[model samples]
Target chain A: MYKYDTYDQAMVDARVAEFRDQVHRRLDGSLPEDKFRPLRLMNGLYLQLHAYMLRVAVPYGTLSSAQMRVLGDIADKYDRGYGHFTTRQNIQYNWIKLEDAPDILADLAKVEMHAIQTSGNCIRNISSDQYAGAAADELVDPRPYAELLRQWSSFHPEFSYLPRKFKIAVIASATDRAAMRLHDIGIEIVKNDKGEIGAAFYVGGGMGRTPMIAPCINAFVPLDQLVTYSEACLRVYNRYGRRDNKYKARIKILVHELGKKEYTRQVEAEFAHLLTQGIEPPLAELERIKAQFADPAFESGLTDSVDRSDPDFALWVDRNTAAHRVPGYAIVTISLKPVGGIPGDASADQIRLMADLAKEYAFDELRVTHAQNIVLAHVKKADLHALWTRLDEAGLSTANLDTIGDIIACPGLDYCSLANARSIPVAQKISERFAGREGELGEIKLKISGCINACGHHHAGHIGILGVDRKGVENYQLLLGGSEGADTSLGQITGPGFDEDGIVGAIETATGVYLANKEGEERFLDTYRRIGMAPFKEAIYG
Target chain B: MVEAQIRFRDDEPVGDPAVTADSFGDQTNASAVRIEPGDDARALLPHLDRIRLVEVNFPGFGDGRGYSAARILREAGYAGELRAVGDVAVDQLNALRRCGFDAFAPEVPMNPADAERAFATWPDVYQPTTDGRAPIWKLRHG
Candidate 1:
């Protein structure tokens, strides 16, 4: 983790004080509601359907065990004893009070965490692959550049009030675990033919009412010019992006309307001008940030063997553990999705327990996956059994990672002010229906969002369910063939929408079709893409 | 008494003698000109030497085109007074100043005592902007 210096601490402290004053002004009737709304939103306070919601940024999805404990403390002290980890690798407290928001921010600032730019039409929290540093196939640990971007975008004057919200994702691995292509700006750190590390820029890709897979604007930008090039991209969008209609205000609309070649040309023009101005940070800054992400000391002679005598522990080890770059180490995922329970909701006690487990078994660092699960990225193989037992006791040891049971869902109409129908109940129902069929489903990604704003990333799910409102009734539309991996593609909606029960049955029928038609060892997405959505649609609608 | 209105030129409040866009062409002798949110700032870049103040109107705080306008003027070497007029608040003061707005003419006057604290809130910033403040990166490397 990047340690905050005196300057960084001072900036955050100032922001907290500024927000506290704004809150006081709003309360004293000195500031009217219309003006106070934007101020509160910029600080991550939202007027939800029930209470004020605060979304705190977990930068690049990395958190210290101490930071996780603080989150648990916040949930217990302020919220309703729980917090929902979102698809954006953030945590939202649903029962926040308007008056206590500044205090919450102050607490987060103490631990070098914040809720800045978590909302509003600014550069949002920069997200990256949760397995960034520990994964075996990573080209580079992307957290350093992510931290740099986080700093650059924070309180940016030019891009702060963009036409619409801007999200950026960075990933170094070939597999896009962070849904990089679905972001407004996606960066893949790659090595050029000359062995120099650079960035591949993807612009205008997003998921919302208008879903787009960002096209490559620049194949390779030198490491030195990454910030300059990104600034150029945003500058073009800030000036030319449509603001007449809120729905069409995202950068995707501008790219779509201007055509990729023209948009790229404009960005290049801006990049040239910015380069002349010498806006790129000095090389020493990059080295300074990189030093913070150095690998922790590892025990070299440890055995790589895990005792698989216990069948339950073996199942979990196979399902929830991933290969690590370091020998005799593994990345362990703590599944938040228990069968018949809400996805991504961790109780205060569960959070504290996970925090303690990270400190004990892992290297005191944790990651929050975009799938809304916690990851212990540097766990030793020998500690698997003990960790599994502790996790099982805490009800966090569900051997259902990437299975039908591990569903990705958004807080839909149940809690969201913009949702048209309920999503959590739908996700719960679907997970319950597929409880014992994890093996049969075979690596299915099922995502559910309550509305067109695809917060659950339903557009990237192998079997996507979107809840819609039709004449005062709840309905769901099924989509097939969406994948957020290296081979990114949006799911195509099947036929008509179904009632809540009908949708659950539809998912079952679709899974049955996959089981019957799949080739040997093929994942659900592979099968869907190979056979197309026709069979699944026929099985569901027929 | 006249209505309380906040106005500034070069971070200091001069009289509210800024001319609106509708009257800007006629007031050729005016040193400061106020442009609406929809007006293009590029048009005034060529006249940078004569104009000492460029006031950009923000009809609503959410309408952020003015921020871009201020940046454009500054990048084009308009070192004159860059004042953000209309719908401005203390929350937006730091950003406006960063985007090269040295003054503010908020639609509603802010309490001067509170506004001073807001402007000096973040003495150091992480990214370099038109405000010319040395970013933390520069300070660290140097």
Candidate 2:
């Protein structure tokens, strides 16, 4: 994990004081709500339905054990003793007081954390593959570049207010674990024929009322010009992107409207102009950042096997653990979605327990996955059983990763002011309905969002459900065949909308179709893609 | 009724009436131009020699296209008094200043002390824009 230097510390400290004054003005009524909304939102404070929601950025999903403990402490001190991890690898506390916001920010500053750029129309918290450093199949770690961009975009004078919110994702593997294509700007670190490492840029992808898979604007940019290229991409969008309508304001719409070639030409021109201005940070800065991500010490001559004596333990090992770069180690994903519970909510105790486990079992580190799960990235295979026991005792051990039970849902009508329906209940019912049978079902990414904002990432799920208001009652429209991985595709709606209970039943019926028609080892996504939406639609509709 | 202006340039801000981008080319004597949210700042490049002041209008602080407009003119070698006009908030002062905005005239007048504090908010910055200030990275690794 990256530690904050003096410069980094100073930046966050300044932001806290700045926001503190803003909050003061707002409370004193010097700044009206309409005027203060963007200022508050930039610091990740949102006025939810019942209360204020403060989103804290967990940059590139990386966290130290100490940082995790502080987050838990903040939840206990300022919020309602719980925090909801979001789809963007950030955490949100639903009950934040306006007066306490400055204090909360000051506390986060102590740990090199703050809510800066978590919301509002600015370059948001940069996301990357959760298993960046520890993954077995990565060309290089992507977090250093992510950090560099994090600095570059922090309080950026020009991009402070974009036409709309912008998102950027980075990945180093061919396997798109970070949903590279479905971002405003997606950078894939790739090697050329000559074996030189560079970045392939993808601009204009997002999933909202309009879902677009970003197109490749530049095939390969030199490693040193990464920031410059990104500046170019953003400059074009800021200059020409539509602002008349909020809905069509994302960079994706501009890219879609302008066509790829024209957009690329404009970016290249900007890149050329910026190159002369010396906008790119020196190579020294990136190297300094990369050194912080050096691999953790791995003990030599260790066993690679975990005892499968208990079927439950074996099931957990099969589902939650991923292969590590070092032998005899595993990347353990602690599932937050307990059956019949909120998708991403972890109590303060559970959060502290996970932090302790990271310090004890892993390498004093944890990561928040885009799927709203916590990962102990370097857990030794030998420590699996003991770790599992502790987590199980704490009710943190859920053996459902990417299964139907491991549903990703938003804080819907229960919390969000933008929500049209309640997503927590939908996720709970679906998770409960397929609790024991998920093993047979194989892999199914069930995602639900309460509204078209897609904060729940419904469009990227294997079985997506979007809640809408019909007249006055809540109705869910089911969609299928969506995947956020390398083969990224938006889920398509399957005919008519269903009532709350009917949607869950509809999902059951659709999965039944998959089971009956599935080949030997095809996942729900694979089966859905091969067979198309006909069978699922016929089953779901009828 | 609030005409308070904060100027950073050594030269006095020209008081000439500003013309729109469409009429800037037509008015041979026009020394100042006003850019709206949608107008391109590059349109004044050819007439930079005579142009003494450029005002970038930000009708709302949330619409940040003015920041880009200011930078484009500055980067294009327009060395005039770049005044950022309209709905400017105190919190936006540092960013506005860093984007090569040497002067400001908020539609709603700001507290001068707060404005000065906002100007000095960041001890350093992360990127080298048209502002001519060395970014923190350069200072660290120069």
Candidate 3:
């Protein structure tokens, strides 16, 4: 975790006082609504359909247990006893009073957190693979670079107020767990023939009203030139992105309209200017940042010898575990998707317990997966049973990781002002319907976004459900084969929109088509690829 | 009414103040305040004028009508007190400075120290936008 130095501290302290004054002005009718709107928005306070909503950045979904506890306290004190985690890895408080927002930001800053640039048409919270440092498969941990980018993009003068919000995600592995391909800018750390680590850049990929699979702009941008290349990409978008219609404002639209070749040409032109100015990052700086991400000391002389016969332990190990690069350790996922419960909402007490577990059984670190679940990376295999029992007691031990019940849902009409339908109930219904399958529906991605903004990133799911209001009635449009990865593809709508019950039935039919055609242990996404959507399309429309 | 402050003309300005904006210069009772817009900014060059301030304007919130003008003034080496004026508020002050405004004349009254304090809340910042100060990351690691 990056701590603020004197300059960093000064900036935050100044920003808080500035916002505090702004709040006072607004309350006193000095700064009119028209004048105060942008000010509030820049601070991550929004006047949504209901009361004001405050979004706090959970940078790369990394939270200290202490930070999580503070967030819990904020929710309890300033809002309803719940806060919603967003697809962008932010948390939103739905019922914030216009007056209390400054206090909330003050609280967050005490723990080195603030919502600045979390909203507004500025660089948003930079995200990366949750398991960056701890992932066994990673060639290099991407956090130090993410932290550098976070520092650079925070309060940047030139790129603030872009055409629309800009997002960037980085991952170190070939397997894109961070969904890098579906971001405005995706940087995957790769090695060269000389074995020097660098970034493979993808531009214009996003899931919003317009869905785009990012195209490779730079095959391998040297680590030294990462900042320069990034600046070039932003310059291209800031210079050319459309400002006429807000809906058509994202850089993806610009990239789509200009065509990939033309966009690349523009970025190359801009990047050349930086090279001419000799503005690339110093090699030493890159080395220094990389050094901060060094792997933690792993325990040697350990082996996986936990008893597997206990049904509870077996079920947990089987469902909620992932392969680690380490021999004696495993990546343990604590599912927030308890059967018939809200998908990603966890009680504050549960947060503290998980934090304690991370400190004890696992390394004193936790990662919030893009799947809206938490991962206790590097948990020694032997400690799995005790961790499972404690987790079971806390009600966090749901053995449905990546199953149909592990649904990712947005705070639809229930919380978000942008949503047309209530996604929570819909997600609940789908999870309950597939609850009986327990073992059959293995490792499927089911995501629901309440509106076209796709905050839930439904377009990236293996089975995507989008809720819309059709003539004042809530209707869901189901799409299949969408993925957020290096091999990213947008899910295509299978058939007509379905009503509340009808959408669940449609998913049931689609899964049935998969079960009939699958060739043993094939994940839903793999099955969709092996047997094309043609079969599922037929099954659903029939 | 206290003093007949002689505002610096484009031709009579001195070395830059290291920061300056139109709003600040316009509102200041300081005689050294310099006001220049359009091509007239170049004329301020030869005077070595004792000008220590400049004022920029925001025509409208959505319209970034004044940002380029402020940057151009900053580029011309007229580093003085940079201020933003007209339709500006506390929200725009941070970005206003990042784009080169050192001070702002909000439509409403405000304490300068409190305004200065507001800029400190966000330690991490992106974008190369700033009035004249180096970014925090650069300052720390530099």
Candidate 4:
């Protein structure tokens, strides 16, 4: 984790005082409701359907044990004992009081966390691969770059308020765990022929009212010019993005309307102007940020050792652990999407426990995966048994890693005012439908969003379900084959929308088709690829 | 005695900015700035200095044109009141404020007491915006 320097600390401190004053003014009636709304949103406060919701950014889903403890404290003291982790690796307390939010932010800042950019039309929390440093195929740790972007974009004088909320994601691994393709700006860290690290830049990819798979603008942006190039991208969007209609205001819509080539040309033209500003991030500063992500010293001579006799441990190891770049280590994913439970949700006590586990077994750091799970990266392979035992007690050890049970569903109409129906119950149904059939469920990513805003990112799921309201009844539309990794592709709509009861039946039927027709050990997506959507489409609608 | 003003409530217009959306329709002070989708923006750029209050209009609640306008106005050294007129709500007040609006006009009848409570509700904040400052955490601890 990057430790906050004096300047960073001072900046947060001053902002707190400023907000306190704003609150004072607002309470005093000097600052009217119309005047105070935007200010509160910039601070990550939202007046939701039932109560005020406060969204706290977990930058790139990285958390220190201390930070997690602080979050736990907030949940216990102020909220309803639990918090919902979001698809973007942020957390939202759905039932917050307007009066307690500033104090909550104060609590978060104490641990170097805050809710800045969790809402509002500003550059949101910069996200990256949750297994950034530990993933086997990673080129370079993407956190330093993510951190650099976080600093540069925070309250950037130029791009603070965009046409809509802008999101940037960075991934350094061969397999994209960060969902780079679905972000406003996606940067993939890759090495060139000369062995220099650089970024593969993708622009205008986002899942909102207008869903789009970002187009490649720059094949490779040199590491040193990352910030400058990024500025060019935003400047282009800021300059030309639609402001006439809010629905079409996203960069994706702009790219869609202008066509990718023209948008790229506009970006390059802005890149020329940005070059004159000397926007190149200082090399020393990069080094400083890089130093923050330095790998912890690993115990030498450790190898992959597991207690094969313990069925539970073996099952968890096979399902939950990923190969680490370092020998004798593994990247452990803590599944929050347990069957019948909310996706990306954890009680305050659970948060504290996971924080403790991160400190004990996996270096003193934890990561929130883009898949809405937590990762204790750099867990020793030899200590897998001990880790598993501890996790089992903490209820963090779920054997379902990416099976049907691991469904990604948003708060939907339950909490979000923007949602049209309930996504949680649908997810619960799907999970129940696949219960005890983990072996049969196979590897298929199912995502659900309640409305067109696509905060649930239904457009990017292997099996996507979007909830819509038809004649005052909740209905779901299913899409298939969307992937957000190195081989990114958009999911296509399968057929007509299904009512609530029909959705689970539809998923079961789709899965049944894959189970029967799929080649041996073929994932659902691979099966779809080999035989297109024709097979599954027949299975569901038939 | 009240002016035929267009007020923002919850980031939306109380009614249409103009009686109709076709034109600005001259008023005593034309705070209703026209946002040409692909306009060069050079005209708005220079005049930003002279404007004491910049009111960006949102045709609907979901229309986010004002967000960009706010950013551009703040960046171009417009230190004036950035008010979001039309389709405003109490829910969007915090976001508008963060984006640089210092005043608000909720669509509902103005209640001075309720307005005061709205701003004072959140005593601490995080994230930097057009207004620069550290959140309360850094102040008390760091």
Candidate 5:
């Protein structure tokens, strides 16, 4: 976990004061709603279907236990005793008052957090592999790079008002847990043939009205010039991205219209110029940031074994924990997707309990997954049983990582003004319908979104369900073959849409096809790629 | 009615009407240039030494191409009064200034007190800009 320096702290505190004044003006009716909307949005306040939703950025999804406690406190103090972790690895409070918003920001500032760039058409909170530092397969920690980008993009004068919301993801491994190819700019830190570390730049990928897989614009931008290269990428987009229609305003559309070759040429030209301008931060700054993420103290020569004496504990360990790079540790993912519950909602008490567990059992830090789960990244394998018992007591232990039960869903028509249909009930129904059979349907990644905004990452789901309003009736469309990992692909829709129950039945039917057709040990995604969408569509539509 | 023009420098008064980038070549006497959102600021690169005023129009606050226009002129060695003229608000002052705008001629009359506050908002900036301000990173590691 990277701690804020004096400068970073000063910047965040200053923003709080700035926003406090803005909110005061808004409350006094001095600034009109239209004028205040962008200002509030810049600070991550949104007028949702019911109340103002304040989204707080958990930069690169890492939080200290103290920070987590403050987040829980914010939920209890300002919001309705709960917070919803979003697909972007940020958290949103559904009910926030205009007057309390500034106070809430001030509170977050005290904990080295703020809601800046969480909303609006700016470079949003930079995300990365949730398992960045602790994963066995990772080449190097990507958060230091992500943090550098976070600082670079924050209130960038030329790019504050981008054509559309821009997102960036940095992944060190080819596993792609953060859905690297689906971001506006995805950087995969890779080693060139010369054995020099650099970034593979994928520009202009997003899921909106149109979904695009970002193409590799530059194969190897020397890591030293990563920020300069990113700036060059954004400069070309900002100067040329469409503004006539909001629907086609994202960088994806701009890159699509310009073609990858022309875009690459333009970016290379700009990057060359910027390199001479001394735009890159000193390499020592990266070393400074990297030092903060140095490995936690581990007792050497600890055993690498977990007791499988209890079957329930064994099942939970098998499903929810990932292999840590260190021998004695495991990365434990606490499932927020409890069966038949609101997918990502955590009560204040539940959050506080997790924060305590992170301090006591794991390291004093936690990471939020894009799948809306919390991870104790450096838990000793010896403490697994005790940790599970504590979490299970608090109803936080649901052994559903990457299962059909671990569904990613958006706060759809229930809380979102932009959504056209409801998404939660569909996820709930499907989760409940398949909870008993989830073990048999291993590694099925299900995602749902109320609208085409794809906030639920429905486009990247192994079994994606999109809710649409067809002639004033809520209709659910089933999409299969999507995967957000190493082999990234958008799901395809089956024939016609279905009603709520019909969609649930359709998933059961679709999975039935997978089970019937799957080769040994093949995940739903693998079976789908091999057999194609014909079987799922035939089974789902028929 | 109050002072809409906030100039950083004492030099001014290019009495010749500012011409658009398209007409800059046509008018030899015009020492001032105006850039629309779509106009290439580089069009005036050849005439930067003589141009005393460069005004970039931001017809809408949300349209940010003007920022690029200002930066382009300044970065191309345009040592003149680069003005941001139109739909400018107090909130954008810090950013507008950072992008190399030394003068402002906004359409809406902003509260002078608020404008003063906005100008004094950040003592330091995060990114290096054409304004020659060292990014906080450079200040840290310089």
Candidate 6:
């Protein structure tokens, strides 16, 4: 975790004071709602369906034990004893009061966190692989670059008020755990033929009403020029991205309207000019950020052994833990999705417990996965049984990771003002329907979004369900073959939409088709790709 | 009676020079000109030296096209007065200043005390913009 220096602290403190004054002005009726709305949104405050919701940025989804404790404190003291971790690796407190917002921001600032740029038409919270440092296949820990980008994008003068919201994701691993290809700007850290590490830029990939798989605009941008390249990309979008239609204002639409070649040409021309200006930070700055992410000391001869005598513990070890780059260490995922429960909702008590566990067992660091789960990235294999026991006590030890029971869902009509249909209830029902069928399902990634904004990332799910409004009634459309990995592809919608119950049944039918046709150890996504959507479509429609 | 709209030039209160809106046909000859959010700032670059004050209209604060225009003018080496007219608020003062707007002619006259406090909100910034502050990264590493 990057510790805040005096400069960083001053910036956040000033922002909190500024927001306090803005809130005071808004309350006094001096600043009208029209003028106040954008200010509040830029600070991560939103007027949701029931009340004010404040989305706090968990930068690149990494959290210190102290930061986690502060979040738990905020939830208990201000909100309704729980917080919802969002798909963007942020946490939203639904029951926030307009008056208490400044206080909440102040508390977050104390722990080197803020809700800055979490909302509005600005570069949002930059995300990266949750297992960035611990993953065995990672090329480099991407958080250093992510943190540098976070600094560069915060309150950026030129690109703050873009035509629409922009999101960036950085990933260094061979497999994409952060949905890199689904972001406005996806940066993959790659080594060039000369063995120098650089970034591979993918522009315009996003998921919404119109889902697009971002194509590679620039193959390899040198590490020193990453910020400059990103500036060029954003400059083009800010100047040319459509503003007449709010829905089509995203960079993806701009890239689509102007062919990818033309878009790339514009970006290249801007990049050339920006390079001449010498805009990128000095190389020492990169080294300074990189030093912050230095690996924690590991014991020389720790055993890579776990007690698998207990079948339940063994199942959890196999399902919830991932291989760590360092021997004797494991990446432990604490599943927030329990069967029949809401996805990504963690209680205040559970949060505190997770924080304490991270401090005690995992070197005081934790990560929030885009899949809506928490991870202790540096857990020792020897401590698995004890950690599992403690996690099981808190109801956090679900053996479902990428299983059908682990569903990714958004806070749809239940809490969101923009939602046309309910998503959590549907996710709960599907998770319940698929309980105890984890092994048989064979790695099914089911995602549900309440509306076409695709906050739930339904477009990237192998089994995607989109909630829609059909003349006053709730309906769902099923999509197949979407995956957000190294082989990124958007799901295609099958025939007609289904009612709530019909959609659950449709998922069951589709999963059943995969189960029947899958050959040898093939995942749901692999099987679907091999056979195409015909079998699944026939089962759902016919 | 409309309150005399306050204007600041280079962080100091300045007298409002009578700047009239010029028609598109006569814009090149006007010493003072008003540009709407929709107007291209690039078109005025050629006549920037003659123009004493450029008022960029922000119809709504949420519509940030004017910010880009102000930046484009400053980047194009326009040292003349760049005033952000209409829908300006205390919260946006620093951002407007960083984007190279030295003057603000907000629709509502801002309380001078509040505006002063807002301008002084952050003594330093992390990134280098048209604001001319050496980026904190450079300051730290240099």
Candidate with best lDDT: 2
| Cα lDDT of model 1 by residue, A1-542, tens digit | 78898888888898898889889999999988888887788788999999999999999999998999999999999999999999999999999999999999999999999999999899999999999899999999999999889888988888877899999999999988999999999999999899999999999999998899999999899999989999999988988898899999999999999999999999999898788766789878889989999998788988899999999999899999999998999999999999988999999999999999999998899999999999999999999999999999999999999998889999999899999889999988988888878877779999999999999889999888898999999999999989898989999999899999999988888888888998999888888888988888777776
Between the candidate structures 3 and 6, which one is better when assessed by TM-score? 6
TM-score, predicted candidate 4 vs. hidden true structure:
0.83
After aligning candidate 5 to the native by TM-score, how far in Å is the CA of A154 from where it should be?
Answer: 0.9
lDDT of 5 by residue, A172-256 (tens): 9988999999999999999999999899999989997799999999889887899999999998888889988999999999899
Top candidate when judged by DockQ against the true structure? 2
Interface RMSD of each: 1.3, 0.7, 4.5, 7.9, 0.9, 1.5
Per-residue error for A72 in candidate 1, Å, reads 0.5
Residue A300 lDDT (model 5): 76
Candidate 4 per-residue lDDT over residues A1-542, each given as its tens digit: 69987667665765665567667667888767766776778788888899999989999899998888788778889998998888888888888987777788787778788887778878999999988888888888999999888877776645655778899999888788888988999998888899888999988898876688888889899887888788878877876787768898888998888998998898787677556644455677778878888988988788677768999888889989999998899999899987789999999999889888889988889888777888899899888889888878978888898888888888999988899999999999888778878877677788999998887888888899999999999999999998777778878899999998898888888888888888887988888888898888888887
How far does residue A178 in candidate 4 sit from its true spot (Å)?
Answer: 1.0
The worst-scoring run of ten residues by lDDT in candidate 4 chain B lies at B14-23
What lDDT tens digits, residue by residue, belong to model 2 across residues A220-281?
A: 99889999999999999999999999999999999999999999999999999999888999
Clashing pairs in 2: none
C-alpha RMSD by candidate, in order: 2.3, 1.1, 5.8, 7.0, 1.3, 2.4
Q: Give the candidates in order of TM-score, highest first.
A: 2, 5, 1, 6, 3, 4
Model 5 alpha-carbon drift over 4 Å, by segment: B1-4
DockQ of 3: 0.22
| C-alpha lDDT (0 to 100) for residue A93 of candidate 3 | 82
Residue-wise C-alpha lDDT for candidate 6, range A94-201, written one tens digit per residue: 999999999999999989899999999999999999999999999999999999999999888777778999999999987999889889999999998999999999
True contacts kept of 3: 0.30
Residue A52 C-alpha lDDT in model 2: 94
Task: Give per-model TM-scores.
Answer: 0.96, 0.99, 0.87, 0.83, 0.98, 0.96
Alpha-carbon lDDT of model 5: 0.90
For model 5, residues B1-142, the per-residue Cα lDDT tens digits are 1123687888744566678889897788888888888887767888887888888888888888888777777777788888888889889989999999988888987888888998877767789988788888988888
Off by over 4 Å in 1: B1-32
lDDT of 3 at B80: 66
